[model samples]
Target: MTFAVAMYNLYDKPISNVKVVKTIPDDFSDPVIRETTEGRGEVEDNKIVWTIDKLIPEETVLMKFTCSIMVTDITKRRTGPIEVTYKANSSFAGGLAIDKYDAYTRNKFYVDTVERDEEPGVWDCKLVFENPSEFILQLFNADVYSPEDESEKFVDIDPKDVSLLPAGAQWHSNKWRYESEELPAFRKKLEFRVMPDFQTNVNGTISISDVILEIASITGGMSYDLTQVPTYKEQDVIAKLKIINNGSAPLNEIAINQQYFTSEFNPPNASEVTMIWDGDEVDLPSNSVKFDSNVFRISLKNLRNSDTGLFMPESILEFEYPIHCVNPVKEATFESEITYLANTFPLSQELEFRPEVPIIEALHLRRKFRIGKEVIPIGALGKYQIILTLENIGTAPLQNVVLMDKVPDNFEYGSYSGGKPQITDEVGEDTLKWTIDLLNADDKVEISYEISGTGEYSPSDAQLGL
Candidate 1:
């Protein structure tokens, strides 16, 4: 019978010559087929030798061997295979003996490098398998690590969905699940079949040493520095700053500096000037933040009209934000258009008109009087009285105010007892007239005339024939 032997290190350190021997029945011809020793590494002659025993036909012969002889240092771990076979006899078939081996199994490995997402967050990890031989490999369980006081869970990566790289071949499954509530202080272990398939008796096991898992979480948000931008000055044109948060977490008790400033209407220069904010401080909302919310308003009562000597109002105004925000608050801007006119001119000057101080316009009679109801009886002289009220809403009093009323064609002119009567129309069109001596501010004059029925006639009748 022939013998085959293999030797290798579990930790990947290389191993040199390993001895092998086999005993056969005396009837078997002393190892026929000529070839004595063969292997992958350096081998000396007589490494595998057999002695003959002619006396005993059935006695078993022992094959002596001494093999630990390679001349290199075995610090690094390695492994290789060895095979032995017996020459086939006429009656029996040749037998092959083989054993898988490794030189080192307990060598330690470390994480060489680590990479994280540009936008901070936890991400999954991957391992590469390079071992070409079929071997058994094991990993340190996640639960075995520290901070595992909590529950543990894991999910296997689905091969159908995950893309497999070169490392995919040496694994039974492309990915496996490993999770533990405990904090990961130590490296985790992962084990797998050295060879992807068992049908082929391949040699060494390849593994990703000390695999690491990552945790995902929100770090800090964007920040704003105030020292870069200083306080705003009066009359200085400035741009607003903006703060934005697109993340899931909300900020707390945020507030911007109160000393922010923007341009305001200036009376002395008759132009838009900067106005620093000195208003009370304000706090931001818990959930929502306004993109263009107004923080403060600058009064524009100072601008005056240069040519018209009137206060010129600013209809459209632009405002800017402060340098620093409570958090890194984004600067916001807004434009306001007032409903009513604030000032008459754009130049800085004196006040031209103040409606509240009794400034009046004109004193012409707004409307004349004709006192007759819709159903004034046809011919019966419907006794009617007409009244007139004259008002002086101007800045000064009105004098020589004369009130007059014309009598309808069917009525007769009446005598005026209140004032001297002046009749301009000869056909008796004048019914009444009055002259008020004087009408002061917010003052008015009232006068009335008397009339009687003349005769009965339908409204459609052209004239009354007395």
Candidate 2:
């Protein structure tokens, strides 16, 4: 393995006669001095040293080296514990002053996987550790980690708290059991300290690989208005479905089967329901469409792998269709079966439709006045005729229709024409109300009444209907 070391001058003034030394372990051989950024030095007594004449403020130097491991036992490997000694020239002292620095590398330990047991939706891991030094290690601890939301882990170690470890000995940790819908990758970290020298610590890591498969379905649609208490009839409704792949491995030869049903009405006929591709009408593909008594099935093939692979975006399939409804059913349901390699049982998804009725928005009322044969001017005292019209321009019919119109204060009530209106007198105004049992779509009603005004008078603005 190759390693790099870097040194920097942090003082404001320049430093002189700087030397850096790195000690090599006995278990390593074939030491090769690959590259150095500044001045160079040679290996002496298994130590690599470099000497520099001067180092300016904020200057840096880097060194690289490569070596081979001579020891076959993992516990016998040791990398580093570097040291540096330097001097600065002081004008007052008239001599070189010595300063020393020390640095330590992370000691090497061994963490290995002993074995693994696997079954559908479950996996168990076994791990082992080795200590290569002559000294005893204390307070040794190990922990395994997995995604919190995706998997559960259980671990067991032979001795709960390992207070002592003999030289060149191996210890086995408790078997780790992982339970999840899909196998998940895990990380293991081992930490320990050598006895009589608690400050000297060692840490090692191990990674485990896993393979998983995930699929999801999402749906959306539009339904007819129900607020108007509309008369039941055949109405067109649209629905869109999307299928996504969210797994690690490549998904191949994917087949999807979708079924739709209604409880209160017959399933939509194949001739009445049509599929659209890219906003254009098209016949359903023969290889993908299948129909039974009330079930409609659609199949898809060769879906690409999800984003967990080399691809950055997930693989997805989407389609839309319009179905006809002739009854006021409680709900319409759509179900799916997705099958792919290694997943023989197939994944399933169910979606129900219970759309809310929309509110009515098309109600209009108008008022007009005529005096015998001429239009009456404002504030004119005369016998004039008032006409009120209410129209239901909405698509659905209305029930229990009531129209209320307030007569101006200066006008006297007269006989009504066209339709009889219930008249009521208030402190300052009179109100005329007309009731209709039912108002069909695009229906209108007109009511006319004669009124005598004592002073200039026009129709009052207060008019309400339901």
Candidate 3:
């Protein structure tokens, strides 16, 4: 969130009145200036203003500040279009220049002559030009003469174009040889301009574009395998949590924490949990899992390593563990609430999900029935007391129950129990039926009947139906 502004002086002369202003984002806090190279910077209302009195040639002024985003969820969070206003005597930022001209100024121009002893009357001469004024100067041409009247030319200098010479600048002409009878002396004529009056006024305004910073967000859910579990028993259930990345930035260092009541459920230790990343199953490292009394927390600095994190754009991270349903005496509902928060300094997004365990209810379901058939020879042969009984012995109710028993081929119905039954077989062959609308848990029912037959007394196993 640190912002820096640099103003460079790309001119031959000093520039003045450098005022730079940058707009701060609405969600960001008031900025505090960190450092300045050659300017005084201050924070104003929703903006940072910087001012510099003057900047010498080749001088650079730098301003820096940190812009930290404190609060933001809105889509459009943008920063400044930094508008800069500066004025210089003559220069442009885009490396452009105007036509060059010259003006008059204080300058020096002369010639030096030297004679060698070996060659009689042979002299070497050169012309020198120096600018000692406070203004820039330009040189066009220079010439030298030996007779002090320019009658005989010794050296001529012309660069074909005007040469820019700044203040305190000096120039030298090429050497020329001359032959003289006496000690050589020379006069010079120079064409030059002192750059003082031909000045240009320059004004500029520059714009530095701002940038958009995206926000990071997260969302997810938790669930359990069983929705309803029968009471009076302990059961193992699988619990899973899914976290999805739905932000513009990648995420790292996740912590998943959950707490459950010990009376209703039991969370698994770290060794039993498994992790699935991006639809691929993997082992949940033991170091990442932590378990306390009734709460467990899982920590992961990243999925793979320090360099890797959540997938770019979007990815899925899942965790699963075995949880047990505590045996209960009555119907009860178990709930578990887990929290997921990204580890960020001074800023983080948290997510929560409540996954309910299976509901336990009172249930009783079992079936046990007894049937008996007895015959007693009381007085005569083939004339005996026939007895048949039906009983229901079960812990649960038997609804719409119909018990049926068939008589032998040679036997016939003579006497029956409290309720009479309809004949269901051929003539002289009948089936005894008993009907019960409802039978409570741990309840029993019994029915008896008497029959006479010519063969031995035998009855098949009873059949019960709705």
lDDT of 3: 0.69
Runs in model 3 deviating more than 4 A are 1-212, 303-308, 344-466
lDDT of 2 at 349: 24
Candidate number with the higher lDDT (1 or 2)? 2
Q: Candidate 3 on 169-283: residue-level lDDT in tens?
A: 8887778888888777666678777654445668888888885544555677877776665566787778788877666656656778887646656778778898888888876
Worst lDDT window (10 residues) for model 3?
Answer: 457-466
TM-scores of the models, in the given order?
0.17, 0.26, 0.38
Give the poorly placed runs of model 1, Cα more than 4 Å off: 1-381, 413-417, 426-428, 456-466
Instruction: Please report, as a residue range, the 10-residue window in candidate 1 with the lowest summed lDDT.
Output: 211-220
Which pairs of residues collide in model 2?
A: 156-174, 157-174, 226-357, 379-456
Q: Which one wins on TM-score? A: 3
Model 3 reaches what TM-score against the true structure? 0.38
